[model samples]
Target: MDNNSILLIDPTFDPASASTCNLLVKVGLDSFSYAIINKETKQVNAVFDEQECDNGAQKFAERLKTDSYLKLPYQEVKFAIHTANTIAIPNDLYNEANLESHSQFFTESHSGNLYCQAQNHFGFTTIFTLLRAIDKTLEEFTYAKKYEQNAGLIQLAEKLDGYNLLLDFTVASFNVLFIKNQQVVFQQCYEIENTEEFNYYILLIINQLNINLQETALNLTGIINKGDEKYHCLLKYFSKADFISVDTDLNQEVLDDMPAHYYSSLLALNQCV
Candidate 1:
């Protein structure tokens, strides 16, 4: 192997499935990662990280040409867009075709080039715009919303009572999905530099939503470890805060140097697609 190679992979993993396969690519603003899974067993065949590339669209196309899986027939592709901010609204009031009007409430202002689409989840509509990180050449495949990937988890959290917070973090991005009384109340992503800033945002959401700190439940996933400062910080305020469970048959050796939990949203796309 070349010491200067940029590819990071687990040599022990042999992602081969005789049946049809699905590809989930998380096209984030700063990070790009993908996984291929068996459509029937839902087991991850392979996981790849594009080792910090700025030109994702170009890399996406080039990789397809070289990656053996891309040539497989009946292979489906799903892209989870994190660069585009997300918001959940009551379906009755949301208009999919007139999304630009709702931009006034988005953390980002709407631009002429921005396009939006809405998907329904448990009676609520998740409206989000797509990020252009990937080149238009690969637009042939259908792109699913990142919020769709979180729908199953959010609904799972709703099965219980009180306030539930789902925090999904990546290499540089973090997403917050708040559920109160079994209803999605808030969903947004935050960019953080440290634990203190992360704490600040959590508190801000709690206060803004008027959630009782003593009764709120926090379920975390993505890029966080049990003993890490990021994990402990949440524990300080919410003593009952815990990481959400993921269903995987992944070999631990393959994830030796990576945080297995951090890929929750991406893995959840298996159900989303």
Candidate 2:
């Protein structure tokens, strides 16, 4: 599927899941939006958002299904139970030593595919020019660069192998694959948060596993409140750790048009490939 791509849309309207393992759909409950990328023209054929309709997805789909923008034959569509973001955890049992362990948390499910959601928030035809920039590179990061340097504060600082960490404060989710000698040794889900109990949960994993923090790279994908100073402060404690924000960049015009929820979906979509 070179010219065309298959996307598993997770259109979640409900906000129930809140752990690391459970599937989540809604990134920003109030922010609903959608977009149409024309692979042929390499532009956003159309865009829409929530304000357009009391119910966004159904309305947008009805309109597009009728007109068939791009005319590429809307191939397939299905709603999935999107998974929560994961993080590598550390042990808190040995407070003095700060040991680590492995465990997962999750969040609730959302409703509706984000594309249609985008349309609901922004006008369907407003961003036609910008959507053409929808290339894979724009959506993913093999290594973190475009993301703010502050986002990498943890990665720039930490060295933890066999230690566990939890992410509780975030609104997203991810999977942590532990690689040793260039091979996947283990994989687990982690939820990084600001709660003391969650922090202890991470330490519990470290202490119980009896692993050293000298050699570990924690991989994560999910929605992070970069605007929150609290998250930055907590990150300061994780010196010797590496962190990356995995998400796509909507052209400035698109960003201005879409709702808040689209950000995480974009991040999740970037990593999905």
Candidate 3:
């Protein structure tokens, strides 16, 4: 049974190219998505979204070896794995022994199953965690937070004038990244029911940062467009609201047809440190 409820795949995928392809995988709370990117052309040849299973992520971790949807040499595969863990510690204040202590405040599980990752920025160091259930996949694949990769793309936009707010969205959840002075100030994920709740969070972020909507530029990505109510609400408050385009030199012919901003996080996985 090769069927795993794939939501999408590229039409031109060549099975012979799997060895050289670089895969980007994200296992979320209730869904999993992956993009198969070509090494030479730097374009996605296939992308897949699968239905939630009892242990969906773990299944994906193991199924990559023999999943019916695609075929490849599991022993020599190259990939990047993404997670949304909220645990992070600053370098100046980080302690190896204290990681479990600090992380416990954010997540219920800080046991051996919890795997940690650290990223260092100029001002502070970020130490985050992942799951050990997927360790074998990380033996060669890069493990990263969707927030970090999404934030990197936003910072790369480099419009750091007052405050830059970048939002990446899914069905009922979203990740918000705040960039200032060419550096990341804060980034967080929230699940909101409606536009009002989303607006409330935006207001708090702006007020906390002491930003002037007249000056701050709010650029958006992921699952939102010009006509969407969420987009209009943002437009109403921030005079300079704009939809962020995927900033890359990837295959233009292949990506021109896709909504670049919507897949910014998936496409920018290679940018994570």
Q: Is candidate 2 or candidate 3 better by TM-score?
A: 3
- Tell me the deviation in Å of residue 57 in model 1: 7.2
Which ranges of candidate 3 are over 4 A from the true structure?
A: 1-8, 29-31, 49-71, 74-85, 95-105, 113-118, 131-162
Candidate 3 lDDT over 1-273, as tens digits, reads 235445455678777777666666655444456667777777667666554444446767766676644455321232333355555566667777756566655544544334444455434444445566665555544433324333344444554455677787755557777767656677776667788898888788778888777656787766677778788777767876676765667663445555667666666664544
If the candidates were sorted by their TM-score against the true structure, best first, what order would they fall in?
Answer: 1, 3, 2
TM-score of each: 0.74, 0.34, 0.74
Q: How far is candidate 1 from the true structure (C-alpha RMSD, Å)?
A: 4.5
Scored by lDDT, model 2 comes in at: 0.29
Q: List model 2 lDDT by residue over 2-69, tens digit each.
A: 12112222243112221111111121112222334322333233333332133223333343344322
Tell me each candidate's RMSD, in Å, in order: 4.5, 17.5, 4.6
The deviation in Å at residue 199 for candidate 3 is 2.5
Candidate 2: give its CA RMSD in angstroms.
17.5
Cα lDDT listed for each candidate? 0.61, 0.29, 0.59
For model 3, what is the alpha-carbon lDDT of residue 7? 44
State the TM-score for model 3.
0.74
What's the candidate order when arranged by decreasing lDDT? Answer: 1, 3, 2
